[model samples]
Target: MDRQAEFVLRTIEERDIRFVRLWFTDVLGTLKSVAVAPAELEGAFAEGIGFDGSAIEGFTRVYESDMLAKPDPSTFAILPWRSEGPGVARLFCDIQMPDGSPSYADPRFVLKRTLTKAADLGFTFYTHPEVEFYLFKGQPEAGEIPTPVDTYGYFDNTPHGMARDFRRQAITMLEQMGISVEFSHHEGGPGQQEIDLRYADA
Candidate 1:
C-alpha cells in the first residue's frame, strides 16, 4: 500500500475511527459526500466505493452511470466539530470509472489536468480563495428575506454576537482540517463574513 494510505489505515485503526466520509466535487463544483464505515476502508482504498455517477451534477449519463470514488489518502483529516465519540474523519476523493480510468467529469481531475499543462510550461499555480458566507437569524419564510444574525458592520469587534461566534468556530475548524487561514473579518454587508486563505508551496 502507498504510505499515505497505510498511514490513513493506521490512524483510523489506532484512533478507533467509526466513519470515514469521502468528499469530491461534481463538474459544476458542487461538493458531494459519501460516508463509509471503518471496516470497509481498506477495501475502499484498494478498489474504491461504487456510486451512481448519473445522480451527480454533470458526472455521467444514466446509460453510463457506474462510478467509483477513490479516496485521496493525503487529504485525510478528522472533522473537528463532530461529536465526541468514535472519531469521524474525511478524505477528498478522485472520481473514476468502473474500469479504474480517471473520470473526465470529475472537477478534481479537470483541475489536475490543467495544472499538468502549467507544469509543462515551467509554471506552478496556487490558489488562495477569499471565501464568503452569511449567517441569518432565523429560517426565511416563502419569498421572505432572512434577517441578519447581527447588525455588526465591517470588523466592528461586535461583543457576544452570533456572527462573531460563527467566524471563530469556522476558523478553528478550518485550521484543524489543515487549511491555513490568513484571517477572518466581517464584510461590509450585514451578517456576511470574509475569510482570507493562504496556501504556499513548501
Candidate 2:
C-alpha cells in the first residue's frame, strides 16, 4: 500500500463515512459501481471484491464470470451530492481477473495500455472533452423528445437563465471532486450547452 491509500483509509474513519463506492467503466464506457462498508475497505484495497463480470455487459463470458475491482487510491473523491448526509465517497477502480491480471475489457486499463505505449515512444498526450448538452424540462416519456428549458443562443446571457445556473452548479460540483472545468457556455442550439474539461495526461 502507498501513502495515498493509507490516507484514504484514515479519512474514511475520521469522517465517519458510511459507504465507499468503487466505480469503473465497462468496454462501452458505461459507469458501474458497487458499495463497500467502510470496515471492508482495507481488505478491498488489498484483495479486490469479486463481481459477476458476465452481467456487466462487455466484461467477460459467462464461462469465466468472476471479476475483481481494485480501487485506485488517487482517484478517490467524496461525491458532492452525497456529502451532506452519512457521507458517501467514491473511487475509480481498475478491473482485474481472478488471477490478478488486468482485465482487457476494463476501460481504465485500456487507457493505461495506450498511455504506456505513448510514454515508451517519448510522447505525452492530453485528453480534453468539450461536452455539449441540452437542458430538457424534465424526463421525457418513451420516444418523446422533451422540450428545451430555454431558447438561448451561443453566449447568450439573460437575467434569468436556467442554463447559466446549471453551468455554475455543475462546475462547482466537479471542482469539489478535484476535476477541473476549463470553460462553459451556451451552445447555438436551443437549450444546448457546453463545458470543456481541463486536459488530463494520458
Candidate 3:
C-alpha cells in the first residue's frame, strides 16, 4: 500500500473510527454518500465499493448501473460533527466503471480533466467562494417572504446577532476539517450573511 493509504488505515485504527463515509457527486452536482465499516476500508482502497449508478440522477441507465467509488486518501478527514460514539471520518471518492476506467459522468473527473488542461497551458485555477444566504424566522407562506431573523445590515455587530454566532460555529467546524475561512460578516440585506472561504486550487 502507498504511504497515504497506510496513513489512513493507521489513523482509523488509532482513532477508533467505526464508519468511513465515501462522498461523491452525481451529474446534477448533488452530493452523494455511502458509509462502510472500518474493516472494509482496505478492500475499498484496493478495489472500490460498488453502487448502483442508475439510482443517482443523471448517472447511468438501469441496464449499465454498476459503478465504483474509490476513496481518495488525500481528502480524508474526521467529521467534527460526528464526534460522538465511535468516530466517523470521510473521504471524497473518484468514480470509476466496473472495468476501472474513470467514469466520464463523474463531476470530479470533469474538473480534474479541466485542471489538467489548464496546467498544460501554464495556468492554474483557484476559487475563493463568498457564500451568501438568508435566515428567516419560519417557512414562508405561498407568495409571501418569510420574516427576517434580524434586521441587521452590512457588518452590523450587535450583542444578539444570531448570524454572528452561527458564523463562529461554522468557521470552527470548517477549520477542524482543514478548510480555511478567509473571513465572514453580515451582508446588506436583512438577515443576510456572507462567509468567504480562503482561495484554493480548483
- Measured by lDDT, the strongest candidate is 3
Local distance difference test, candidate 3: 0.92
Residue ranges of candidate 1 with Cα displaced over 4 Å: 140-144
Instruction: Look at candidate 2 and give me any clashing residue pairs.
Output: none
Off by over 4 Å in 3: 138-146
TM-score of 3: 0.92
Q: In order, what lDDT does every prediction score?
A: 0.89, 0.90, 0.92
Candidate 1 — what's its lDDT? 0.89
Model 2 reaches what TM-score against the true structure? 0.94
TM-score winner, 1 or 3: 1
TM-score of each: 0.93, 0.94, 0.92
Model 1 residue 152 lDDT score? 70
Candidate 2 backbone clash number? 0
Looking at model 2, residue 130 earns an lDDT score of 93
Please report the TM-score between candidate 1 and the true structure.
Answer: 0.93
* lDDT at residue 142 of model 3 (Cα atoms): 98
The residue-by-residue lDDT of candidate 1 on 1-202, one tens digit each, is 7999999999999988899999999877888999999889889889999999999999899999999999999999999898587799999998999999999988889888998998999989888789998889888999998998877777878768788788889899999888899999988888988888886642
